[model samples]
Target chain A: MDIKNMQEAELKAAIKKVMQDNFGLSDIADDADFIKDLKIDSITRMELLLKLEDEFGVRVEDNDAQNMLSVDATAQLLKKIAG
Target chain B: MASKIVVTGLGWSTPFGCDLDQAFDALFNGKTATFRTQNINLDGLYCQVSAQIPRNEAIFPFEKWQKELPGNKASMFTIFGLEAAERALLDAKLIDQEGGYVDQNLKIGVVVGSGIGGLEDHFNTSQVILEKGANRVSAFYVPAALINLLPGHIAIRHKIKGPNQSQVAACSTGAIAIADGARMIVEGRCDIMVVGAGEASIGRLGIAGFCALRALASGYNDNPQQASRPFDKKRSGFVMGEGAGILILESEESAKRRGAKIYCEYLGAGLSNDAYHMTSPCADGAGAIAAISDALYWSKKTPNQVQYINAHATSTGLGDAAEMSAIKFIFGDCIEKNSFAVSSIKGAIGHMLGAAGSVEAVATILSLHKQKLLPTINLEEPDEFAYHNDKLINLVPNNGIEASLDCVMSTSFGFGGHNVALVFGRY
Candidate 1:
């Protein structure tokens, strides 16, 4: 739950696990866009954001949810939130 | 001459396990899969017993299925349909080693049916709207809840590009789907059709809705296993059940060319309406008789040819008696003399509603393939109303009976007097 202390690699690994474990996407890339590459529709995006928030114990602003569409972007956002 | 349509494969994700042999064996043994559920507060609802798919626990774990379709926000009925479709296609060898299409140009079609689409999801979304803000509602709610999306998701997943449709006729939905799909092959509309029905409406709303109608068994809450006693003198009402049944139907020519393993021939379907009442069937069984007669007529077979019947007796008093009367009218005094065997699988699996017809159709086909009649369990004393001439119609009570069956009929009548009967013959 203390995602603020998670390293960049750990954050990325967690994100990858969420994609594979939660969404059942095994072929996701480090920079794969949720919408474009993974076919995550609008509803799924909301679900993914909620899941990320739950996993990281971080509050994702509505505006930031739109920007955090890729794993890399999500990791960056997590780092920003932690800072 | 009407083209012959044969079933090449069948799949079901039932409260009973999916293994055909095992499921049939359990049904033969009169094993009850229903149990008391805490999913819905029994204090608020009358019926406490339901045949629910065991989820994320011992027995049949749903976690593996969850992994297969991760983040699947679709309704559970759609998920069940997709899973059954996958199994059926695999059984038919329609998929290649790489899990791709065996023949991309096979002109396959899909017809799936459901009684109430996403009632659970609809209830949840409404709760979210009431408890949380309106903005908290998810976008997938509508797509997951819509009925037609059952086939739409299937076609998209399996790349089936021929005729696509979904049916809704309450409990008769499954049989109508199978009939309509078989017609597609007979009419040269498609060479192969994936047909069946899935239902997952055992949630609060689903149970409460039926409870309000006083259509569910309420007295056997303590003994859940005995809740669904179809065709029995003590039978009170039907027990709610949920699952899916999908069959791979192919033109006889196509099946022969592919060397497909044929299970049984889907001769034809007969459809009729009672025009009597919204919920109750015609007391004289006219609609049921006409439907069965029509099915026999469409199949060009005589009543004497039907060696077995998988009845749609939902354990309700009048419903069982009416169906028995219809069969007597069709088969005459021979029925009471055990000329042919008859049974209802509801005693084991309960009433599957929209999926009942297709599920029982699968049971009928399996009976044909295995040459064994499934027992109508819990029929301790066959209802007097189902008896004719001081004899109970060969209801195949208590234990399964082995018999050679050349042709069998499965009947399904829904809430709106929707009567459907389908005849299947040995391939």
Candidate 2:
């Protein structure tokens, strides 16, 4: 699904589902840091970047991928990319 | 005082299916799970037949796990181990989503072994290093390839805090994991131990390595179903299988206090080394005999009391016959009287390598639980060479055998002449 056109709520839901299903995680907060809160390592971070790119139908630059560390940041980036 | 150990839960992922009843039924009915696979790059390889675990939506449901794991962050080995361990914990009634009765204060241990760990990740990482540079390699490559990390991941996933370790003894890894995990419980090191093995080495490197050793069954590539014929006159070699098996073991006192449904007692395990060849077993079967004898001795059970054996017959010409010689030497008249029933599940699922022992141990424990013996399919005519005493016992050939099983033995021998035998008794 092209997640680029998704609204803020839809984007957040999509991100939440990815975190839960991919990482065997639950109870994720919008402010939760992927590294600090989710305990996702660098490998998982790379995986998250690729998944978000595929979901939004937008290519994530390496620099921007590093900046998008939390759910809110990721959704914001997705909105900017979609626009 | 040492505590008594018992298996309260069992879980496994195999080619046939994960449901114990359905998987065991298929195995007993001579159903073959082997198939032709082009997944592994076998351009120059001789054997193309393998018992690869198909993406079963009902059992593993990777599509669900994939939403979160879109990239190659998680290895196939890790998935198998996690899935099996989760089911085992649920089966033991130790944990649920809301967190069941597993005490957070208690020290829980995990021993998930593997014969070959994360070969696909290793292969990809090496190519990256060669083309780009060492600095360009993925950070997860090292942790994913290390065998010990299997248990590390499990312990972290389950929040298990205690003696977390893994045993990598090639094919004997699964049996050794159970043996060592039980020892930890008996020695009062942990209240509960999650023990088993996982193998997902069906990659290009894995297939090439084994094929170079001439260790695979190549003739039946066109007929994948008949590729792994253990103890048969036409037996050649084992077909590579990928999966995992996990068993939840707890102290007898802990199990009783928690009112957990017990499966079988983890009597004891015997380990020995041939100190001979690296790949071939000794013709005399000296290591195997000692391992079985030591298992019986440690379990304090006589030869007459054990009525069934989950043989390590890996469908090899020498390996099959050597194991039978050892059995006959130990169980003697039991074989003649048909009192001892022997079977190998390798014929159905092929050789799972590291997961073979633990998976077959599950099969053995299921036999004890259901009071039945599973069949060793594809054994049309027993190889005359496999018989040492000139006596043939009920091999449970090609069909399931319904019999009362009180105690059972499961054996696993690896490439390094590593021999491990485990005995389980009715709880």
Candidate 2 lDDT over B48-85, as tens digits, reads 98888887686566774455344455678877777778
Tens-digit lDDT track for model 1 on B258-291?
Answer: 9999999999899999999999998889999999
CAPRI quality band, candidate 1: acceptable
Per residue, candidate 2 scores C-alpha lDDT tens digits across A16-36 of 887666556678889998888
Off by over 4 Å in 1: A1-21, A25-32, A35-43, A50-65, A75-83, B56-61, B96-102
Name the regions of candidate 2 deviating beyond 4 angstroms.
A1-43, A46-83, B67-70, B98-101, B131-133
Q: How do the residues A1-83 of candidate 1 rate in per-residue lDDT, one tens digit apiece? A: 57777788888989888777767877678788778887777777787777777677677888877898888998998888867
- Residue range with the least summed lDDT across 10 consecutive positions in model 2 chain B: B64-73
Q: How many backbone clashes does candidate 1 have?
A: 0
